[model samples]
Target: MSTTLSSRKRKRGLSDAKQSDSLSIELSSLSDTQTGPVLASFPYLTLPKNTPFNVSVRGEEEGKEFVRCSSTIAGETDAIEFSGSANDGSDGAGSRYFLALHRPGSSKLILQPTPVYLISRQVKALKNFKPTEPSSSEHFQARSMLGKVFGTKKAKAAIDAQERNKIDVSAMEDVVGVLQDRIDEGTENLPTQEKLQDSANAARLIPAYNADAERPEDIYPLHNIIPEPEWAALDSLLSKLKNAADDRSRVRLLPNARSDWLRQHLMLAYSSPKPKRKIAKMLIYASVMFAFRGVAGRNVPERSALLERLSPAPEVVVDGLLARFTETPRGSTKARMTSENETNLLTHLFSLCLKVDDYATDTALIASDLKMSPTRVNDLFKSLGVTRLFNVVMTDQLMFVEIASGCTIGKLSSQDLKRLGLPDSVGQEKRAILKAPLTFPKPRLRRRA
Candidate 1:
C-alpha cells in the first residue's frame, strides 16, 4: 500500500502455499547480490544443494509456515552473509540450530548441520506455536553454533569479566575504606549516657581497654585464621576457594561438621552518634557477606573455607577511607536535608558505604568538611541503614559472585542466596530513613547563675 520503508513489495497472500507436493522451490536463476521469489506457493518444499532462497516477509500474518533455514557458509561467500552468536552457550554449542521457520507460530529444532530440519516436518510437528522475533531466532542459531566458532579460553574470559563486573581487588578495598571513615567519624558523639547502669552496658560495646589501639589498616591476613595456625589455614582455605570449580573440589576440602559461621561487618567512617550500634551493624553485614562468600560456589566445603579465609575487612575499610577523603565537597549547604524530605540524600551516603560508586555524596554531608557530631549524628546512619544493607551485599559481593560462578546476574543470583552465599531474605522493612540538614543540634548556652 505505502511505498516507504514500511511498505511490502509483494502482495499479501501470494506466498501462502496450499499443500506439500504443490510446493516447488526454484533457485537456478539466483545472482550473487539479489534476493529471489517463490517458485511454487507450497506449504512444504525442499531446497536443492547450493540452491539458495531469500523471502522478504518482515511482517506476515500469524500461523503461517516460515522456513527454518541454517547454513555454515565458507570463510567468504558471494551471497548475503551475517554473523551469528548466542546469548549464552547452550548444549556445548552447535548441537542445536534455532533459526525461526515459516509456520503459524515459532519453532526451533536441534538439527544436524548436514541434515537440516525440514519445514514440512517442523510445521507438522510444532503443536503449540508462539510468536518469536528475528533477533531471538538469530541468537538461537548463534548459540547452537558457538563451539564451531570460538575457542575455549575466549568463552571463559567473557564469562569471567561479566561475573565479577571486572572490579579490581584494589578498587573494592578502597570502597570499604571510605565506609570505615564515615562510620568512624559519625560515632564521635554518643550523648554521654547520664544513667549509671545504661552507661555501664554501653561502655562494654566499645571496650576502653585499648592499650594497643588497632588501626583499621593494621590487620594481618592471618587475623581471620585463628584456632588453626595462619600459614596452614590460609593455604588450605586459599586452595579450596581457588579450586572450587565443581562439587568434588569443595568436598575434598572443609571440615566434616561445623556450624555455618560467618564474619560480617560494615567498615565505614560516618559522624553517627552511636558508633557502637553502627559497628554492630557493620559486623552483621560483614557476616552476611561472609556467609554468602563462604557458600558462594559449587561445594559447601569450599564455600565454607572461602568464607572463613575471605573476611579481610581491614583492607576494605582502609579503601573506604581513601575514597571518602579523595572527593571535594560540592560547594553548598543551603539545601539542608530532612528525614521526611523524600529526596534521597541519606541513601546515597549508604551507597557510598556499599561501594556502589566511588564517591561519598549523601546530601546530608553538605555541612562542614570537619563533620564531627558534637551533639549526635548516628541518626543519619540509622535513617538509611536498611537501604544500605542491600547495597553493601550487592556491590561488595558481586566480585565474589563473579569469581565463584563466572556470572553476577540472572538465575545465578537465586542460587547464590540459596546456598547461604547470599542472604536468603532481602528488602525487609527496616525503619524509614530520614534526611536532616547538617545542623549540629547544639544545646542552648546556659546563663551564668
Candidate 2:
C-alpha cells in the first residue's frame, strides 16, 4: 500500500489493539437448530473467547448494573462502518472490536473497539421559518423619506426654475463650518447615507412636521418588505464595509462573495434563461457599484491607499448614476434598472452596489420595470439627481464620471506634478503651462485637515 495508507493503518491497528480484549461471547449459537438444545431458559450466551473473566459495571447507582459489558479477542479485522443498533449487542455507540481467547469461558466477551454504547436514538428534523430583510422606516417613515428624497426635485426646480436670489459669492466658509460641525458631532449610525443628510432632511421636515418629528416605529408600519428581520444582516454588512478603512476606499467595493447576502440574488438572477440571466446579473452588479462609488463613499474618504485599491477601475462602465457612458461586459446583457419598482426589485443588488462596481441604471429601465414608459424613468432620474437624495445619491458623481476620466480631477488642480528627481524637464514644463490661470474665479476654500 501507499506510505500514507500504511501509516494510517499502523495508527488504526494500535488504536484497535488497545481497545479489544481477549474474550467474547457469540449469541448466534443460541438458535443453532442442529444442536436441538431446548431454548427457553437462558439468552443462549456463548463465550467465544475464553470466559470466566472479571466484568466491570459503571453507573450512577451502586446497586444495579446499568451496563454489563465484557471483552475478548476475536480476530484481526475492521469493524462495521455504521453503528446505530443491532439485535446482538447493546445500542451500538463508540468503536467496538472483538478478540477471541480459548483460555476464557465460552464465547461471551467483547472489547471496546467493537464495544457498544447504551444510548441510541433517532434524530429529529428542524423547523421552518419565514424570509425577510431590514426596515428603513425605523429611522424615518418610508413614505416621508421617499417624498423628501424623491420629492425635492420639483421644489428645487420651482425655486430655481424661476430666477432665484443667489447666495453671497461667499459665505462658503460659514457653510463649510456648519457642515464640519455636523460631520464631527452629529449623525446617526444609519446603514444608508441618510445619516450624513441631517441638514437637508430637516429642511424638508420642518414645514411638514411643524411639531415634534416622530420616532422610527411610529412613522411606518412593519408591513413594508424592508422592515423585516432578513434585511438586518444586509444593513450590518453595509455599515461595516462603509467604515472599513477610509472614505476613499469607498471608491472601490469588492465585497467577499461568501459573506454578502446579495451574492445569492446575483446567482439567482443568472439562474433562469442563460443569456438573460447573465445580463441581468451584470446590470445588477453595475447598479450596486454605482451606488457604492457615488452614493455611499462620499464622506470620510481619508484612507488614500486603501481607497485606491478599492476604487473601481477606469474601465468600469458606471453609466447608472450619470446615465452617459456604458459598455456591456462579454457575458452580460445591456440591461438597466430604471423605476422605483426596479429599485425595490433591485434592492438586493443595490445593497451590493453600495461597495462593488459601477453600473448604468437609467429611467427607461426603471419605467419598463414599473410597466411604465421611459419618460417617467427619465423624469425620475432627473428629479432624484437634484434632491441629492440619500446623502449617497450623488448628482455629479456619474455625471463627472459619465464624462468618464476624459477629464481627471488632477487636471483641475494646480499642485506640482513631479516625475523622477533627475528627469522630466519637458513634462514638468508642459504641466507648468497647464497650471496657468484661466478666468473662472475660485470659490472660498474650507480649512484643511
Candidate 3:
C-alpha cells in the first residue's frame, strides 16, 4: 500500500511541474512579441494642486487619413498616460510608422484589428456609484497625495519693453509731427501702432503719410453699424422723398411722428453725459432733410442751445458743401457753388488736416509725381473718392474735397463752420483763394462778327 501511494504522489508532482513550465513559457512569449507600433501619445502634463483632468474613451471610428480614437480627455483626475495604435491598414494607404518611446511602466497600448468602442459594461455600474464624503483618513490621504506629487509652480509673466511703453496720445498737429520724426529716423526704427484707438494712430504709424502732408489719408474709422434691414428702410425712404411728385407726398414722407422719433433719437445720442460723436453723426446724417431741419420748436428754443450741447459733425459739414458745389440751376452751365461754399470746403479740409493723421492725401499729386496720365488720375480719384472721406481737387490750387453725398442740395453754410470752431484766419484764407479768377470756372467768350 505504501508503494502505490508513492507512485501516485510522483505522478501528481510531474503534472504540477509541467503546468508551471507552460505558464512561464506563455509569459515569456507575451513579453517578447509586440502587437503593433504606438500611434498617438501626449506628454505627461503637471496639474495644479488638488486639480485634475478627466479622460474618457468616446468611441472608435475610421478617419480619412487615420483611424480617429474618438477618445476625449477631460475632468478632475490625476495624471494619466495614454498610448495606442488601432490601425488596420498598416501595409498601405495608412499612417507611416514612427519611432516611439519604449519606457518602462508605460501605458498598455492595444492595437485592435477592427474599430470598436473601448469602454466596458462595468463603466455603466460606475454611473450609479454615489460619491460619499471621506469616511476614513485613508481616502483623504489618497486624494491629498496627488497635490504633493504634481503641483506646478507658476512664475509671473515678464513684461516686454513694448508692453511697458504707455500709449502716447497727442492730438492735433502733434500726431503728424511725431510721425514725421519717426519716419525721418529710419524705416527700421518705425513706431508700432499696438493698441491704437483709431485711424489717427494708423496714420502716425504709416510712413507714407508722414512723407507727404497733402495726401488724402484714410483717417476716418470704419463704421459698419447699419444692418441690411435698416439700410434698406433708409434707402427706400430717401428714394420716396426724392421722387415725391407734390407737396402732399413730401409732407407724407416727413410725418410728425417720424420727426419726433428722429428728434428724440438725436437728443439721446447728442445729450448723453459722455456723448459719442460718431453715434450722433450717424443719427443726424441718416437723411438729408433730417440733418438740415435740425431739432426745432417748443422742445428747443434757440439753435445755440442745441449747438452748445452737441457740435456739428465734420462729415455733415463736408457733405453739405460738396452738395452745394455740385448743385446747378435748371438752365445754368456753371456750378452754383458760392464764394462761401468754396471757403467752407477749404476751412473744413484745413481743420481736418490739423486734427486727423494725414487726413488729407493728394493721390492726384502722387499720380502726377509718378507721371501717370491725367485721365488715369481722374479715374483713380473717382475710385478713391468712394472709399475716402474726401478727395484732393488739383486744378489751379490744391484743395482736399469730398464729393456730394447725393444729388440733393444741402443748407450748411459758413455760419455752421463758425459754430464748429473754425478760426477766422482759415475763413479769410479760403475767401482770398476763392476770389482769385483762376480758382473759378472762366466764362466762355462770345464769337463776334
Candidate 4:
C-alpha cells in the first residue's frame, strides 16, 4: 500500500509542473501580438504605420474645423468614401470616418488635407475681420509715410517691373539726354566750372553728425580759433605726427619749426611787450587747442611735453581751457560754432587733460568743467591710467597680485582693459611658491649682567 501511494504522488507532481510551463508560454505569445511600429503622434493626430491606408478625420473646435484621422487597410479601388455624421449638410462634431487605400492586404499611406483645411479656414476668418475700406484721412496719412520712405505705389510698381527684366544702362541714356535738353532750353547759360566745383564741395562735405566717419584731413576744427594760413600750418604739423609708425616714433617726428612757432606764441602770451596782442594770443590758443586735439585723437605722443612748454603755470592752463568756452569754432557759413563742433572739441580737450594731468582739480569737477558726467570722467581716467587705481600691489622684493589686469583687478582670470576701462599697457603674471624653510625665529632672554 505505501509503495503504490508513492508512485501516484510522483506522477501528480510532474503533471502540475508541465501545466505551469505551458501557461507561461501562452502569456508571452499573447503579449507579443501587437500592431506594427507607430510612425507619429500628436495631441490630436497619430500615424500608426507607414503603409497603404486611408485617413478620415472630422471635428470642430471654437467655430474652427478640426481634423481626426481614422486609418484602414487599402482595398481594390484607391478611392476612399467620406461621410459626415451631420445630417444637416454641415460637418458637425462627434464624426467618425475611415481612410481606405487601393490594396486590401498591403499597407500604404495616403496624404490628408488637414493642413490645407486649417490654413484656408484661418485665411477666410482673417479676410472677414479686416476692413474693406479705410477712411480717406487715414489712407492719405499712410500714403504720405510710404511716399516719404519709398515713393508712391505707382513708383514701386515701376521699380518691381524694372527688376523683373534685365536692366540695360543704355535705356537710361535717353532719359538723361531728355533731362539735359530740357535744362538747356530753360536756362540761358550753363553753370561755370567754379560753380560746379563749389556744388561738388558742398555735396562732399559731411554733416557734423558724421564728422568721425570723415577723413582726418577733412575734419575742420581749427577754422575759427586760428586764421586759415595758421590752420593749414597746424594741420600739417599734426598730420606729420600721425603718420609716424607709433606714438614714440610720433614724438621723434615732431616738427621743430611748428614747436618754435608755438613757443613764440606762448612767450608772447606771457612776456610780450604788448599784453593785449590778440594775434599772438590766438596763435598761442591755436597751438594749445591743436595739441589737445592730437592727444585726444591718439595721434600725438608728445602732448604732455607740448603742454609743459606751452604753459608751465597750472592756473594759466586752466584759464586757457576755460577761455575756449567763449571762443567759437567756425561751422557752416550760416552757423558759427555749431553745437556739434563745440561738443567734439570740448571732448577732445577733456581727453587731453587725462593724458597730461595738467589739472590738479578733482576728476568729477574736471568732468563737470568738460560738460561730461562724472562716470564718463572716471572711465577716461581708468582707460589712460591717469589715477593709478588699477595698479597691482608690490613690495620691495616681491609682487603680490591679488588681481591684475589692464582695466580692473580681480582675484582670478584677467579681463580686457577696455571692459574695465583700463589702459592696455597693464598686464598680469601668475606665480607659484616652490618651497620655503620651516624655521621659526628664536627669542633670546635678557642677559643677567
Candidate 5:
C-alpha cells in the first residue's frame, strides 16, 4: 500500500508540471495575437502615384483648423475639393488622423493631418498689349481745334509771355529770405582796400587784363611822375622789349648806343648842379616799371615797327636790382646761383611787383579766369610776401623805402634784409645805383655764411 501511494504522488507531480507548461504556451500565443491586431489597425494614408502636391496644417491660433492641399497639373483647370474626417475611433466619432512627415532637411518630424482641400491652378495666357498709333488727320484736327480755342499766334505768344511773367507772391517772402542770407555770406568777409589793390595788380600781370589797356599811362602807377620826353623814351623801350622773341633777341634789339643814351641821360639828371630827387627817383621807377610791364605784355608782330626805333633795355638794369632777392639753396654750404635761378628770381620779382600795385582789381574776374578761389589767390600772395600800406599793397623792399625818411631807397634793417633774401650790403648797393648811370653789373657767385 505504501508503494502504490508513492507512485500516485509521482504521477500527480508530473501532471502538475505538464499543466504549467501548457498554461505558459497559451499565454504567449494570446499576447502575440493581441499585438498583431493593434499594429494592423494603425492609421495610414496613401497618395496617387506621381501626384505632386504641397500639404500644410493650419493651427488653432491662426483661426484655422484644417489642412490645406495645393497641386498643379499643366494644361488642367484649377479646382479645390474638401475631404472629411479620415477615421472613426471609440473615444471620439469622426476623429482626425495625423501623418508624420520626415522632410529631408528637417531635424524633427512634423505631425500634420492629411490635407482637407486639394487645390490646382492653371497659368493664364499672356496678352499682347500695345499703344495705339495716332493718325495724321487726328493730329491735324487736334492742332486746328487748339488753334481755334487759343486764337492767333500773337495771342498765344502773349499768353505764354504772361504765364512766364506770372509771379507767386506767396513765395516772394521766402525767396527774399534766401537772397538776404546769400548777400550776408558774400559781404561778410569783403576784402580790404589793400587786398583789392593787390588783386588788381595781379590781374594786370595776367595777359588778359593787360591786353585791354594799350598805353602804360592807363595801367601803370606813377607813370606821369617823369617828364614827357623821358616817359616817351621809356615807353618806346618797353614796346621793343615786349616785341623781342627771347632774352637773346632782347639783348640784340637794344644796342649799346641806345643803352648809353639812357645811361647818359640818367647820369645827367642825377649829376645836375641841382639834382632833383623826384626826377631821379621817377627815372628809376619808370625804368623798372617798364621792364616788368614789357615782360608781362603779350608779344605782337604789329609793334615790331615801333621797336625799330632806338630804346634802352631797362631789363638789364632791373636784373641787377633784383639780383639781391635770389634765395640760396637749403643745406648748401656755399651759395651757387645759376641762369635758371636768375630767371626764377626775376619771375618772382615781377609777380611780387604786380601783386602789390596801388590799384583795385576785380578778384572775382581773376578767380573766374584762373578757375580758382579768391582765397587761394590771397594765399599765393602771402606765399610771395607782400606788405600792405594804407589802401595800397607793395613789395617789402618798396614798403621799406616808402616808410623810410625822405621816402628814398635806404638801408634796410638786418631783419628785413634777411627776410627779403638779400645780403647785408644790398640796401647800400641799391642806394648807390640811384646816384650813377644805370648799367648791368657783372654776375658773381654769392657766398652764404
Candidate 6:
C-alpha cells in the first residue's frame, strides 16, 4: 500500500511542475513582445490663476483627425494632470496635444498646438512656461476701461484749461474786445458785402405762394412754459435731454407740456437782481442750445425774440441775427431770400443733405436745424429739385430726400429723372395749340347823357 501511495504522489508532483513551466513560458513571451514601455508619459501644464483654458489630445484615425481626450480647465485652476489611460492602448503615437484659450467679450478662440513624443517610463513638464504679454488691442481695451472709470485725459485737460482761463469781473470789457478782434480776423476770408449781395440777387426763386391755402392747427403749437426751478435740477434736465438715446427720447424729455422750459428758466434768471445770475442763465442757455441745437425744434427764433423783448440786450440782438441765418420762409413764395447771409446759409445747409455715406437724407433733421415746419421744408426741397421718398423703415416723421447725380440745384433734367429709377411714361402724346381772335363792332351814343 505504501509503495502505491508514493507512486501516486510522484505523478501529482510531475503534473504541478508541468503547469508551472507552461506559465513561465507564457510570461517570457509577453515580456519579449513588450520590450519597450507600454505606457506613454505626457507633460503636465501650469497655467495662470483665473485663466480659462482647454486641453485636448488629437490623433489620426483612418486618415481623419479626431480628438482622443479633452478636458476643460476653468478659471482659478492652475494645474492640469493626466487622470487616466486611453482605451485604444496605442500610446498616442503620432498624436498632438493642443490648448485653447478664450477671449473675453469675443467669440474668437485661440488655439496653441504642441508636438508630443512618447518617452519611456518618464513624465515630462514644461520648465519655462511664460505668460504671453498683452497685445496692442488688449492694451487699448484696458485703457478704455480706465477711461470709463476716470474721465479721459483730453477731457481733463480741457476742464483744467477752462479753469485757468477764468477771468475777473473787471476784465469783461477787455475780454469782449479780444473776442471781437478774433471774430473780425476769422471773417476776413468770408465773402465781401457786395459779393454777398450779388449772390443773394442771383439766388434761385422759391415757388409762387398761394393765398387760399389753409394752415394746420398744430403748425405752431404753443409750448407749455414752466416756471423757475432749482438751477441744478434744471441742469440735470438739460443733461438728460442731451444724453437721450434717440430723437424720440429727446423729444419725449421736453414734451409739449414742458416745452421751452429752459427758455422760461432763462427769462426768470434774467429777472433776478444779481448780474451774475443773469450771466449764468445766459451761459446755461447758450451751452444747452449749442450742445443740442435740435431741442425745442427751430423755435430758437421765437425764444430769441422773447428774450429781446424782455431783456433788450445787445446779446439778444446778436442771438436773433444768428437765428435769422437758419430761418426759412414759412410758405412757398416767388420772392428771393431777404438777405445774402440767408441765401448762403441755405445753400450750405442744402449741400449737407447730399451725404456720401447714404443715398437719402432725413429732411426732418434738416428742418429741425432750419427751424422750419416739415411741410415747408419739404416744399423748399421740392423747389430745389429733390424727390421726396416714402419712409419704408416706418420711422415717425422722417421725410427722405434724394437727388440724382448731375442734377441742377433747381432743375431736374430728363436724364436725371430717368436715373432716379422712376417708372417710364406710359406713352408719348402730342398736342397742338390754336390761337383765335374775334372781331367786334363799337356803337356810338350821344343823346342819353
Candidate 1 lDDT over residue span 1-449, tens digit each = 11112223445677754322222222223332232222222233433457443333223322222222222111112432222212121212354322222333322222111112222223323446677767975874566467436648777566555545755778678589899899988976755434543554333211111112242112111122121232222343443334445433432343211212111111121123333433333333333232332233222233234335544322343223223212223793222222222113222223323321111122223212113351123334333211101111233323211111100111223543354233545322121222222112323333332
TM-score of each: 0.15, 0.16, 0.18, 0.22, 0.21, 0.18
Off by more than 4 A, model 2: 1-199, 202-229, 232-357, 383-449
Residue range with the least summed lDDT across 10 consecutive positions in model 4: 21-30
| lDDT (Cα atoms) of all candidates against the true structure | 0.30, 0.31, 0.34, 0.36, 0.37, 0.37
- Residues 304-373, candidate 4: write the lDDT tens digits: 5545544422334423343442233366222123343445454444333322221111354444434467
For model 5, the run of ten residues with the poorest summed lDDT: 20-29
Which sections of candidate 3 miss by over 4 Å?
A: 1-264, 281-326, 329-449
- Taking the tens digit of each residue's C-alpha lDDT, what string does model 6 give over 1-449? 01111122334545554332111111111222122212334345444555543323333333322223221121223333333334244534665555545556643444444323332222224435667999986885676566656877886576566557766668687688888899999999998766764564345442122212232111111110111332333454455544556544544444121324333333433354442433333334333332223332244335444344323223432344345434556684222224444444443333223321011334455455556676665554444331222223322544333232111213233553465333335112111110112111232222321
Model 6 weakest 10-residue run by lDDT: 20-29
Model 3's alpha-carbon lDDT is: 0.34
Q: Of 2 and 3, which scores higher on TM-score? A: 3
Best by TM-score: 4
lDDT of 3 by residue, 94-168 (tens): 443333232355332222232221221223336568887776666745644554455443211222232345465
RMSD of candidates 1 onward, in order: 29.5, 31.1, 26.4, 26.7, 30.2, 30.0
lDDT, candidate 1, residue 49?
Answer: 55
Candidate 1: where are CA atoms >4 Å away? 1-235, 245-449
